[model samples]
Target: MNQSLNRIAAMTARYYYILRSSWLRLLEIVYWPAMQMMVWGFLYTYLYQSRSAMADTAGLLLGAVLLWDVLFRGQLGFTFTFLEEIWSRNLANLMMSPLKPAELAASLMLMSLIRLLIGTIPVTLLTLLLFGFNIYALGPGLLVFFLNLVLTGWAIGLVVAGLVIRQGLGAESLAYSIMIVLLPLCCVYYPVEALPLWLHPVAWSLTPTYVFEGMRAMLIHGVFRTDLMIACLALNAVYLGIGFTTFVLLLQSARHKGGLLTMGE
Candidate 1:
């Protein structure tokens, strides 16, 4: 048990050392999320002023944006940390260490949480100050919703990381772009029903779809859809399981093929 903890700790420290050494990386954690919030927050404000149908737009849109970032930042946090090792040529060193795949994943999950907090907290507070919107108003279920989205992001990140591990940097671009493909399917800015009937099943398959739907329901109708929340949680668990298994298999495959050593070259 202690050995596993140490492995996880060592992996976490490796990334922490990198983050501490670079001011730009630290600044980047906060910059992009804040910038995105500012742009969308203003657009949401404009819609509120211009559209009677959007009278209560601030809470709904801001909440959706913030929640969406939970997923985005979570995935970026995990993949970027993994990619950083690749960029610094540290992947080989780490792979050669006593660390196990599960331990490395545990470390990445912790790093993702840290990055998610660093990236989202400032923007969340800014929204409260500038727009007088508190997403927490969605109530206790907010925590569950946030976890569901973050887990979903982690699942996707793990898949991307696995692909990169097995296929090398050729697959690295998926780390940044996977979420974009997932965004529309997630129903972030709109309801699932707004999508074509054919895509409804696809949207529903992605857990965040239910999460955002639940968020809109809470904001617009003062209704908390526990069923959606439950579904999201269950789906997240399944996806997370699949993601972790895939990552471990790919890492092992890479080790067998000497892909880890080649990655640093």
Candidate 2:
């Protein structure tokens, strides 16, 4: 236990030093999310005041955007942790260490949480102070909704990380592009019913769809949908399992193919 904790600490320190040294990186953590909140917050305000059909427009749209970032930042955090090691040419060194793969994963998960907090907290607070919109108004269900989104994000990040492991830097773009591709299917600013009839099933298969749906339900209807939460949790479990397995298998494949050594080159 002590060894695992030490490994996690060491890995944390590794990224901590990188973040500490780069002011631009720190700015990036806060900038994009804040910008997104500001733009969406205004649109939400407009809708709230002008749209008679949509009563809870502010809560619904703001909640969806904030919650969606939890997933986006979470995935980016996880992928960037791995990408950092690769970019710094430290993957080989880490692989040679006594650090186990599970420990590495735990450390990356911790880093993901750190990154998520750094990125989202400011935007959340700004939305509250500036727009008088508090996502926490969703109440205790917000906790469950957050967990579901972060877990799904981590699952997607792991899958992308796995691909990078197997394909080297050639697959690194997945870190940025995968989530965007998934954005439409996630039904972030809209509802699943808004999608084309054929895409409804595809949207439902992704866990974030249910999470955003549940968020809207809580805001608009004042009822927490336990069924959507259940479905989201179940789907997340399956995806997480597949993601972790794929990451491990790809890591081994990289090892055998000498891909790790060339990763930095």
Candidate 3:
């Protein structure tokens, strides 16, 4: 067990070192979030000009875009970090060691957080300068939403990572497609009521739905829903449990079938 832990530490340090050495990696992380903020900032400004009634939603959509990126970065961070092992054809080596799946999952979560912080902080800062909107104004609520978003990302990422292990790179699209499917239902830029009445149940059942709804309530109505925050935390717990369990099972299946040894090829 101690040897496995040591190996995990070495693997983490190697990846961290790679990140530190790669200036392009840093720039790539900064690029997309900044790009999104620019596009959305212009859109928000245009809406404020074109529709007097839309003026009240100045930072609402922009804020959602920023917050949603947290979740996006988190999931991608976790999955891509895991896939790095495969792309380097090192996953089989790790699996051949005493390293356990749970340990690997936990490490991936930590690395995801590191990448998320690195990716989003600059974009958040830039959004403030570009739009004069400070997401930090959400105060402690900002932290709440951030945690839930990352956890939700990890949940999705775990499932993606597991599937890739089971079915190879062909299943890789699940990483982005699954999140895209949830985008409309997440109530990111609009309230859940904007969806059809029939889809309301499905939307509300998602953790991010409460997150965006609560964000809107706070920003627009100055009303913070403790209920929504509580709901997100509760649902995240359940979803994360399911995601982790599925990952472990899928990984075991892959190992038994010897797919891990040949995944990157």
Candidate 4:
């Protein structure tokens, strides 16, 4: 166990070194946030200015934007960083070591989590600073919501990483494509009330919506909304189970086919 911890520490330091490269740091601190702000900021403006105004427009949009971006950051960091090892032809060198695949996966996931937090902290503070957003009213429930979202993000990351291992870059694109469909259906910028009644149940089943609602309920209204919190927790578990299972299956298959070692070559 001590040996495994050392390996993870080394890998994490390597990733941090890569992250500190001036170009990547600039992209993370400036380019990505600006692009996201432009797109989601526009939507936020529309939501507030129009008569068909969104429910808790500022909070809903901000929460949605933050949550979705964190999810993207975590999943992409895990997938692309692992893929980078392959692109650089260094994966085999690492594979030759005593490190197990599960340990490698865990270490890569830790890097993703770190990246997500770095990106998220800045954007979250910016949202509050620039948009007058406030979640403090949510009190301790805020922590619960944050944990739920993070777990959901990690679950998504595993599936994304697994698919990239199995199908290469095309699978990477497909993994992201799922987000395009999910963001709308998740009711990030809008509420389930805005969706067709037929879609309400489906939207509620999605974990993000529950987190969003729970945030609004706790912070905006000072209500517990235990049902929403419970729902988010349950859905998070389901996603975690599905994602981890799929990841293990695909990873084992990839190992058998040498897909893990040969991808990006």
Candidate 5:
């Protein structure tokens, strides 16, 4: 019994030594969970405005939930597909294949679309049947909004996959844990104005913020918010470029460093 106890203690100490040497890992120890804590714990503080100002808009909250799920599911779909390859220890085999990164990315994206449809279609219908709310009633703007959110998800997922390839499995959990940080920043359940005055700028910097704000505008005013749509597109372009660049560079780095060969070890 004492021998087993010593082994457990030694193993714990070994990782603590690793954590001591790695600042990013240490930061992640706090930043990862703290971001989620901040996301959910304080996300509701912004909802006071919805209750007070959007009280009469029947579909505002419901619409936000549906759109939020679109973004969430889209990201998971993209990231998990990539993570699964890593888990299965197939990344080296993938890299050795003739497939290009962009092609791989496209395949992941198509998978994301399929996953999003699989997860969302039934829920949307259930919302219609149970709550008498057809998410489709939001109309053509909803399609644009959905597209932008998915683009943002793809961009984030690509960056995440890149980081894992470059940094190894230390970041493996990020695929699941990272996106919720946007729950607060994207103002999913509330308007941007609901955020603290300082957070307004931070929230606006993200494309999904525009999508959610546009969603609110559509629900409340019956306007499509073409201006927000334009802004969302512009930001999505920047994020997608960054994500693509990051992935390609990190992939090259991993390959050069033999990270791919030893990945998942």
Candidate 6:
């Protein structure tokens, strides 16, 4: 027990140090959020100008986008940090350390939380303050919603990392492809009802759909519907489990294929 506790402490402290590195500059933290905010802000203004009645609807959509940015950015932080280490060949040092793979993974996930806090949290807070949306109105439901978002994002990161492990940089094209597919389906700037019925199941299966819905529920209605919150929590757990399992399998495959040690020579 003592050994496990000490290891976690060390990993967490290392994560803190890594987060403070120049690579994680304030600009890097804010860049994605700013881009998302600008694009969505323009769209909202345009929609409001076209139809003044859509202002509240636009607010709901904009809030979802803001929250999604934080979740996506947090997961990306973990995956990219690990990938950069691998590209620079520094991962070899980590692999040879007394630390375990799970510990290293934990550290990366912890870094995700830190990045999310530094990057995503600010944007979320700003959206609430500017749009007069109260995320905390649902209190515990808000917490559950955020947790679901984090887990789902982590799962996506794991799957992306697995592909990177198998195909190296060549697999990176999938990132854009994923974004293209997800943006319309994730209910980022619109409600799921706006999507055709045939696509609703597909969208809801993506986890982010439920997350956005739950967020909208909490923010717009200020009431936690037991069913929605429970569903979101379940989806998060399922995806998080899949992500961790896939990450482990890919890590093993990489080890067997010598991918773990094959850095830029």
Deviation from native of the Cα of residue 109 in model 1, angstroms: 0.5
Candidate 5 lDDT by residue in tens digits, 9-35: 443343345446778744543343334
Q: Could you report the Cα RMSD, in angstroms, for every candidate shown?
A: 1.4, 1.6, 1.7, 3.0, 13.1, 2.9
Candidate 4 residue 117 C-alpha distance from true site, Å: 2.1
Write model 1 residue lDDT over 37-81, tens digit each, in one string: 889888777877786777666667888889988988899899998
Q: What TM-score against the true fold does each predicted structure earn?
A: 0.95, 0.94, 0.95, 0.83, 0.78, 0.84
Model 5, which residues run further than 4 Å from truth?
1-58
Off by over 4 Å in 6: 38-51, 128-138, 172-180
lDDT by residue (tens digit), candidate 4, 1-265 = 9999899888888777888776766366446855686577667666766777364455566666766676566666677667667667676678779877677777887887777667666776666566556445456877777778777777777787777777766776755566667787877666679899999989987888887776556545678888988878998999988988888888778778775566677
Worst lDDT window (10 residues) for model 3?
Answer: 3-12
Cα lDDT over the full model 5? 0.77
Which pairs clash inside model 6?
Answer: none
Q: What would the TM-score be for candidate 3 when compared with the true structure? A: 0.95
Q: CA lDDT of each candidate?
A: 0.87, 0.88, 0.88, 0.72, 0.77, 0.71
The sequence of per-residue lDDT tens digits that candidate 2 reaches over residues 151-217 is 8888888888888888989999889889998888889989888999999999999999999899888
Ranking by lDDT: 2, 3, 1, 5, 4, 6
Per-residue lDDT over 66-168 for candidate 6, one digit per residue giving the tens place of the 0 to 100 score: 6677567756776775676656667667767776666666777877787777886666666556544444555776677677777776777777777777667
Candidate 2 lDDT (Cα, whole model)?
0.88
Per-candidate clashes, comma-separated: 0, 0, 0, 0, 0, 0
Q: TM-score-based ranking, best first?
A: 1, 3, 2, 6, 4, 5
